[model samples]
Target: MSTIDVVEVQPPALWEAKRTKQRTVVWQEFGLLGIFTDQKPKIKQDGICSQQLLSTTEKSGVMDSVGVPGPEEYEEQHVHEVYEQIASHFSSTRYKPWPIVESFLQSLVPGAIGLDVGCGNGKYLTVNREVFIVGSDRSTNLVKIASQHQPHAAIVADTLSLPHQAGRFDFAISIAVVHHLSTPERRKEAVQEILRCLNAEGKALLYVWALEQKTSRRGWDEGHEQDVMVPWVMKTGKKNPNEDGSMEKTFQRYYHLYRSGELEADIAAVGGKLIDSGYEKDNWWAIFQR
Candidate 1:
């Protein structure tokens, strides 16, 4: 097996070491810290970018109201920034549409206008050209790829604060998006944001990673930590020993695995009436209406 293609669990020691390593690369690469190595590092994938989008030598030092790292700050460092960096590689592996989400999109009526909250790479955008869909995500790079679907649109926007007007969309889908929120409040607010865009009778379908995915390779069970960092290992397929000789890199993305019935509880908390809900493919999905 090629060293670059190998996908194994990262050793805890090495992972911690890399996590706290000196930020030799400019702090602006991700606005906080980054690592540049002169040699290739072993890559590992715990589960599931090409440019320094923003660059500077100093830290951004962005913090929440309390002056310490809060939910937004934590997500920016672990979720948003990581997605921006690995958008290309992440998009490549996410082309296959989940069966449930596909059916949801296909079932939409023609001429219907909908929102795809956190539509990474907009794979579902191609599902139904007959219905107009506006896909939005926080990562600009992923939005760029999502915009390639004709007749559909993608924009860079946070899930917690969507730009659309209230109660305008016919439907909305937030597959694999809510799990990225680092805290319960943020996650519920994200669901509320989706519901806010729906008409009084409009519906929304949301999916989140499940904490009970014991059969999966990750083996996350009920007792496992619900809030954790999952690594996405990308093989760049190029070697540049002279500069940053990183043939591969691993990014840690934040996720809050939903336990059984947790998704329904969130919907209820957001005042959304649950229409239908189920578990599929290591994920919890719920279709609800406002």
Candidate 2:
């Protein structure tokens, strides 16, 4: 069995590694289609956000097949990572405020156990007292900052390689971090892992840079520094110092420039059903149902 296997097996590839009698095994493979970003609390009825929300019940972003990371590329990934390490916990992002996070959480309805899946700086998780929340991220340094900031609600883990129980959550929120994944495989793995942790009816919310938005604002466009944005495997998993006086081992992740269709396909392939999705100005946000 693959070390990564956690679900029942019927392996057609990875997750479908078991055999069973078949009869033209069919699936609703309608070409997947599908992110959005906006912080308007108490939105106007039947407005743009409302329209996008309505469309999601039928069709969402974009959907398309994606390639896996090469096996050779896996072992080759090893390097030190320097992550941002200021204790920026409490309600707002480095760019905005706590109420924005609260307002977003409020839209999801009350009492849904939620997660800040790349909950950097522990900002929202720290001060937003109403939601049943848990915090997770790939960076140990950032996790430390989170623990120091909101010790009650944090866990250190990678979305690519999660360390959580299956169906353990009701909802997950990722903000301004999905694009950093760098590759399609990592992207799928991240989504798959997150879904694995959700209850069947659970939700996964993401705040991502909008593909339709002008590329000038994103760091991955041309003239972007490869060494800075795309991480390099330094010494093959060896511990090393980074920019912020912390230590990390670089894992293989490739940043992707998403189109709507590709995002939708990803959610469906992993047994997910998209609920609501849209893009607003600079970022894209979507919520998927497991």
Candidate 3:
């Protein structure tokens, strides 16, 4: 991605429902730190940008707070930066929501209000006008992009501490954002925030990146090292091992990969139920009824 993409992000301009002094900042990484790639994620190769957008890099100095930025802020900032970087690799105009999100929306109650948390550019808004949908993302530029794409859709704020009232949306869907969270503690909070926003009996749909059960754990970017408890290697690289292990690994962090059974336990801890869960397109999509 071009450095110009950074120039496009305005930290002060990021979306905020109401600016408050000493606002309680929720620092959930949302899995941004998990991009443990030996290779730098480039826009061109990732197919996130076209040649024209890559020519320039925008510089927006980081100006959130005085002390070291917290993990959530760090991850959030990283995502915005990556978002800009990837923009150079692909046309931001083109979009198509994944089948799971689309299919879930199809079952919505008439006049049901839906929240697309991390709604990237509001492509779903254009497709599902039948339901009242509001798309929101922490990235100010992306929100603006979404506004341009889906003018009718409401785009605003971060999910960590949402501005909306409890039970605001009939259902809330967070796709591909959970994996950005580096730690499970942060992810659970995100889940709570989402659950808090849903009405009783409301559904919260989430998609988490997971490795298949049958796949060998060795191929992961974060290799597995041997476990003292388990016979085989739990981790391979230097420090962090077992991060690349089995489904149990992801739950309690037995593996870097995520498995349905592991996630279900995590979901249960937060008083959320995984009504339906499955693997599709390398993502474990869970439909949770609160």
Candidate 4:
């Protein structure tokens, strides 16, 4: 009774208010007992406390720590956006068709129905008029450009999910396109989609950037990531248009570089019979029969 005075300590107003609000939400959502029963908060590598509201595995499928988009999302956004932004520049540089591609088109039977998946600028579509070719691409801008260049029809459609009927096309070609699929699953899906659109005896051709190209005289480097965004520098002119001397703008395009046998293996995985496969001129080409 003689003389001790009791004192109470309180957290700072702002911090205490935030804590109160959090507690209120927790209680409202899970009830008061849940505050104790829930798992302890986890400190992330970045030194922030995670709510521990959902299991790590539950959220891991959609996003990583710090909320970065997963591979599929990143690939879709990057590939489509970059292609749209640089469609004109890209089309201007893609006027020539590869000789091998031309040969494959020439081999197709006359009046045979064909599909061109990811037919940028429709370079290959212009070849082999005897074969009625329909082109599809993911980029609308590229599709428009393709429509202007080729008399064949062009549609903005994804290779993984073509708008065509199954077993409709006698032949299909996906040149330098499957490599844009940033994951093995996606690459396989695209090949399978192509196969699905083909008749039982239908054949398809695929081209992918070769990993061996790094050793070629062209000096193409296989970057550290198998799936990477390669930059395309568009130079305004040799002379600097700006006083500051910046005449080039770099844009990123997605690519999945393939090793010697990777393209063959991917096609085979989808029950496609490989007719022939080889590495040529910084690319891996394969002919497959459905």
Which segments of model 1 are wrong by more than 4 Å?
Answer: 1-67, 241-246
Best by TM-score: 1
Give the number of colliding residue pairs in candidate 4: 0
How much is the lDDT of residue 108 in candidate 2?
Answer: 60
Query: Which lDDT tens digits does candidate 3 get at residues 61-160?
Result: 2222434355555565555545543432222544777898888888887788878787766666666666777778766666776776433465667767
- List the candidates' TM-scores in order: 0.77, 0.55, 0.60, 0.73
Better of 1 and 3 by lDDT: 1
Candidate 1 residue lDDT tens string, 1-290: 22232222211111222223212211111211222333333222432111112213243222112244546766788789989999998998998899999999999889999999999999999999999999999999999999999899999998888999999999999999999886678889999999899998798999999988867766567865566556676766765322456555667676778999999999999899999999998999999999
lDDT per residue, candidate 4, 131-155, as tens digits?
8888989889999988864458899
Comparing 1 with 2 on TM-score, the higher-scoring candidate is 1
List per-candidate RMSD values in Å: 9.0, 17.0, 15.4, 17.2
Candidate 2 versus the native: TM-score?
A: 0.55
* CA lDDT, candidate 4, residue 272: 95
- Candidate 4, after superposition: displacement of residue 12 in Å? 43
| Candidate 3 least-lDDT 10 residues | 225-234
Residue 140 error, candidate 1, Å: 0.6
lDDT of 2 by residue, 1-290 (tens): 11111111111111111312211111110110111212222222222111111222222211112332232232123111434322222222353433434566666655667777887767666555556777877666676666665334778766666667888787777776666664456667778888888988788876665444333322233332221222222322235465544343232232334555566777777778888776655556677878
